[model samples]
Target: MPYIASFDIGTTNAKGVLVTHEAKSILEKSVPITTIQTEHTAEQNPDQWLDAVLKITKEWLSVGIRAKDIAAITFSGQMQDCIPVTAEGEPVRPAILYSDARAGKQAERIKDELGTALIREKTGNHMDGTLTFPKIIWLQEQEPVTYEQTASFLISAKDYVIGKLTGRLVTDPTSAATTGVMNLEKRTWQTDWLERYGIAADKMPEICPADEVVGQVTEQAAKKTGFAPGTPVLCGIGDAGAATIGAGVSQQGEMYAYIGTTGWIAIPTKEVTYAGEGVFHLTHPEPGMHIAIAPLMNAGNAYKWAMSVFGTNTKMSDKFAFQEMEEQMQASDRRTSNLLFLPYLNGERCPVQNPDATACFIGIKATTKREEMCIAVLEGVAMGMKQVMELISDASDYKRITLIGGGSKSKVWNQIIADMLGLEVLVPEESQYLPSMGAAALGFINLGWDSDYQAFSQRLTAAQTFERYIPDPAMSEHYEHKYRRYIKLYPALEPLFETSLDSE
Candidate 1:
């Protein structure tokens, strides 16, 4: 039986899933990877991503999954990464992650030199430090040697891996859209914009559609990954695009929220409509559609931080802390507390684009304990998503939203989102695997096993096993009143995280 290998090179891990043509899972493997971080930098060794995938595939082979049994390979990976590479497909430097915002000045320069409206009109994004173009500029100005040695720049993690596999230099439209260089409508790079930014057009990879077979595994990649040398590889979409498709959001105006290391709320539309500067527009996996995503830089990571702070300090392992925190949050009474948390631990992108914003607990009393603070963190992230949902769609557009991600596994957080949105939140049993499932669906289409994204959606929806969290009427008013105040707190605090005195 032919199987599809789908991988998501995520911020926290490299996860791969093997699924049949009809999207039935065969085996799954994940390897945890490290991230290097500081005040203004977040980076990972792209070599780690390559290493992780190789290790996973070897494990899959050990389990009797033949190399030739894998019919096609596709990927869903982190977006907006600035990875400089040599001609030999080696990473020149650690990949600057999407959360890294060290290019604020460069972003401002682009917005200033080019008209704001012109940039927004063409790129469908407000020029910001979180994008790839400004980060490239930052590399040129700050680290001239790395910039000069770079043969090409790639936006998504999977693009780097694909280059190593097939020696192909190509990116999908979904990843290209995040660069703030592509003409969002045409799904092609703007050569003139690249020239204006002093980036060579040749350094940019060719933009390809998501479902196309852009490359085939080389003998070298086969040696490293234990895959058949000539196996076809599809140009898969980015992680958000995968989530959008996996959640069965095929119809227009259908919305879904994904909470991983980062989080986003997305709704598909027939036209590209400008909601705000923070909102992101991407070409949908299916052609001629757009997915407007309002993203949160801090979601599951905030929960991770809260556990580190409030959990047991006796050990560094999170397995114990998570179980203990889950019980405490569930056992505690959350009704009386008016405490609110701002989940901007790494700053925010959507709802507000302030990169220097900080997180804080408001309305905390001397009597407040760790349990209440933990509950506030969950509520705070949920509140942030509520702001994004309103931005991406009309109030009536999304009757219910499919929520998928690592955070979707949390029953407490899931219920909070349902209560906050006043809508049903469906968590598919395979929430953590949806992005990879979406990748598999694309692989199936390329293999001629499925007709279109809608067909895949219908097939998956009919067989999906999900846990539904219905909205709680008793807590809606409580959350609604708190949300009114949570929306106002950021504006009041923005001036505090302004331009650094030491930056100049």
Candidate 2:
């Protein structure tokens, strides 16, 4: 049986999955990619991403999977990473990650010069430090020597790996859209904006359709990784887009919620729909489709923080931490809790685009227990997701939402999201592999294993096994009241956060 290899180059790890032509994932592997972080910066070496790919491929090959059996390779990855490479595809330095805030001043300058209306119309996104343009400007101002030596700027984690394998520097529309450089309607680079911002046009990589075959694995890449020479490589989509496809959200108005380290509520749209500022409109992997996304900086990480604080006992094993937390959350009343949490632990992106926003647990009294705090964290994230859901609904109506990513594993959290959104939520089996499956689906279409994306998506959707959650009317009413209070927390705390940042 022919197989396709799909790679998901994520923030914490690079995951590889081998899927049969029938869409069954036969084997999967992963390797950690370190994020070098400081106060306002986060980065990773591009070479490390390649290394993880090589490591996973070697492991798969050793297990007796022939290189020839793999028909094509495709990718889905973390977006908004800025990797400056030489003409020969050598990294000038470590990549600037999407979470890096070192380009805050540059981003502000770009916003001031370009104006919000023009940027929103051109790029389909707001000006933010977590974009490639600002990071490039940061390099030009802060490290002129490095900037001068740079040949091209690559966006997304998988773009760097694609360059290394095929010796071609290219980006897909979905990934390029995040750079704040691509014209959303045209699906190409905005040369006028580049010139206005004083950014060189040559630094931008060529944009390609997500499933187009851009190049093949060169001899060098074939030797380093265990792939056969001349294996077809498709220009892949961004992780969010891939996850949308994998979750069976291909038609207009179909929606999905992704909860990884970060989270977002994404809905597929046929036309360019703009939700005011702080919401993102990005290209979909499928041709002529767009995805409106409202991203959150904190989701699973907030849960992780709670775990670290409450699950540090010597007897507490990592395996049991989730179960214990779930039990704690279920111990509390489902309808009411006096405590409220603002899940801006690492700042926020969607709904409120504040970088200095800090997390707070309001209504904390002497009688509050640690268990209530944990429950509050879950509820806080649910409320934040509901905020994004409302923003998407402002543009279009979506009743059913498919949940994917690490956070989907928690039934307690899933139920909370359903209750908060007052909508039906569906969790697919093997939800974490959604992104990889999406990439594999693209690969299959590019290789002619499938006729078209819509047909492929339908088959995959029909095959998917799901668990559905229905919202309780009483619980939904309770959350509606709490959500009103949650929206007030950020405005009330904005002045305090601003003062702290200014003092620092």
Candidate 3:
């Protein structure tokens, strides 16, 4: 049986999986990639990603996985990263992460020049500092010497790996769409827009379809990764697009929610559907499909914050922290509570595009208890997701939702989402590997082992059982009322957030 190697280069870690032609996992490995985060900056060395991949491949080869057995390799990575590299594919500096907000001034300049309406029409996304163009502009203004030396600006994390492997600077349409420089309708780089922003055309990578064979493993890469020389490498997609296909969301009106450190609600559409401002529109990994995305900057990380504040003094282990918190949440009243939380710990994306937004606890009083606050955090994130669902529903009707990612492991959170959205939520078995599996599916297609992704996905997910969560009628109604209040808190607190003396 031929094997395909899939890689998912995430914000915090890089995961590798070997899958059979039939899409069964044979072996999996992951290694941490260090992220250098500061108050207004988040960066990671692109070299760290290559190191992690090398480590994973070395371990797999040591365990008797022959290089020749692998048919093709594909990647899925964190989207919207700014990695500037030399002509020889060496990073000039640390990669600016998607969460980095140091390019706010540059983003404002772009908005002033191009206007948000034109940007939305051209790119299908709003102007934000987290995007690729603004980050590149920041490099030009703030670090001119380095920017001048930079030969290419890669967008997605996997693109960096692709550069190192094939010595070709290229990106997939799904990843390029997030760069704020791609013409969404044409699925190509917007060279005119880049020039207007003072970005050279040569600085951008060539765009390719996610399933196309962009290059092959070079002799150096083959030696380093234990792969056969000239093994085909497909132009893979961003993690969100991969996860969408991986979660079996191939049809129109099908939706999925991914809650990692950040969270997003994505739905496949036959045409471009803009869900107002702050929502993202990107090309799906599958040709001719579009994904309407609403992303929240904080989701699983909010739960981490709660655990740090409330679970630190307890004797519970990290693994059981969420379980204990779930028990606490279950003990609380199901109807409603006075406390509400704004999950803007890392600012926010979608709905509200403010980088100055801060996390806060509202409706706190002498009667507020610790458990109520904990449950409030869960509800707050759920309410945030509800806002995204509403935006998506505005564009298209999606009744069933598939939930995937690290946050899908929590039944309590899943229930809260189901109740908040008043929709059926299905959590797939082995949800964490969905992105990798999606990448593997792309590899299979490129190698002619599969005719289409939809059929491959259906077959792969057919045997997988999902835990279903239905909305409680009473709780759904209660959350509907609370959601009204939750939406109001952000606008009411906006003035204060701008005037506050807090400095990043």
Candidate 4:
């Protein structure tokens, strides 16, 4: 049987999964890469990504995986990371990662200059550092040399990989949507926004559908990666969109919640599901759909931070810490931590696009143990997620919620979210790696492993029972009071964060 290969280049690593055409997993592997950080920038070298991909592909092939039997290759990747390539398709500078916030002024300028309605009509997203258009403008203002000489702005990860495989310079619609360069409703690039932002439309790649075969593996790519030369390379979706697709939230009103380093609540919708304000929509990396998205800056990352401060020094291994933390959480108090945590470690997005927000721990008493503090930190992240969900609920009625990601692995965290939202959270089998798995499924669909998306999703996804944690009436009352305080704490602290930055 012909097999399919899919690559998911994530924020901190590159992962590849080789599977049968039927979406049965055959082999999976991951390689870690560096995300270089500075006071004002968070970046990854595009060359580093290419190197990781090359090494990973070669390693997979060395395991006796046949090159010729691979049917098609596709990708899913981190979005909003902007890397401008020279006319010859070489990196102009290190790619600005999704977490970078240096483009704040540019984002504000665009929103002020272009006005929100025009932007809303064009990109279907609000202007912010998280979007690529501001990053592009930032390039022009901050690095004039690189900006002037650049030929195309690539939305790193998938685009870079596709460039390597097919020698074709293009982007998938889903990825393009993240760049704030595509009209969500029209399914085409927003040329006027480019003109307004002083971006060169000529330099941008043509937007293509996620499942469309944009290019084929070259002789060079095949030789290095042990894949067959000329295998079709399909335009791939953004990681979040791909995860939602794989999670089977394709129809309107279907929702997904992911708690990773960052957390987000999304609903796949056909018409713009604008809830007046505070909710944003981006085109699903799929061809003709939009997904409402709101992100929490610190979700799993907040727990990791707490563990680092109070638990064993585990070198930031999420698995080891979670296993150790889970055991301790069961023995701890349910409602009384005497500690309150806010998971805004890296500022915040969605509902309140405040970059000046900071994490906080309040009401600590002498009786507060390290374990209690850790649990409190987890609770804080849950509350933060609840804030976003509440914002989403203001717009639409969300009934069922699918949970995915690293933090979702924790029973404690999962139950907290379920109780907070007062909804049953479903965790499908293989939920943790939904993004990459979605890419693999898309690879199969594009390769003709199945007829349509619905058929493919049904065959690929396996439903599993989730341990439900209904809200405790008393604890719910406690959180309701604490949540009101939590809401007020951030606004009070916002000015101080900005003041500190100014002092520095």
Local error of candidate 1 at 172, Å?
A: 0.6
- Residues 1-504 of candidate 4 have per-residue lDDT tens digits of 577777778776787777765566656777877888875578998877778777777886788877777788878888878888876678888889888888888888878888888887777777777678788888898899999988888885888878878888888777777776678788777888788767878878878878889988889877776678889988887887787877777777677888777778887777675563446676765456777777777887787787778876567586787778887887887676547787777877765777667778888887778788888888888777778777666423765588887677788877777766666777776566667778776676665677776676777664333444565667767777877888787777777777874576
| Candidate 2 vs 4: which has more TM-score | 2
Q: How many residue pairs of model 4 clash at the backbone? A: 1
Residue-wise lDDT of candidate 1 within 381-470, one digit each (tens)? 999999988887786656788999999878888998999999899999878888988888888788889999999988888778989999
Residue 256's lDDT in candidate 3: 90
The numbered model that scores best in TM-score is: 1
Between prediction 2 and prediction 3, the one with superior lDDT is 2
Sort the predicted structures by lDDT, highest score first: 1, 2, 3, 4
Better of 3 and 4 by TM-score: 3
Better of 1 and 2 by TM-score: 1
**Residue 349, model 1: Cα distance from true site in angstroms:** 0.9
The 10 consecutive residues of candidate 2 with the worst lDDT sum are 391-400
lDDT of 3 at 281: 88
Looking at candidate 2, what is the lDDT of residue 29? 88
> Which stretches of model 3 miss by more than 4 angstroms?
312-317, 394-396, 502-504
TM-score on alpha carbons, each prediction? 0.97, 0.96, 0.96, 0.93
Ranking by TM-score: 1, 2, 3, 4
Q: Local distance difference test, per candidate?
A: 0.88, 0.87, 0.86, 0.76
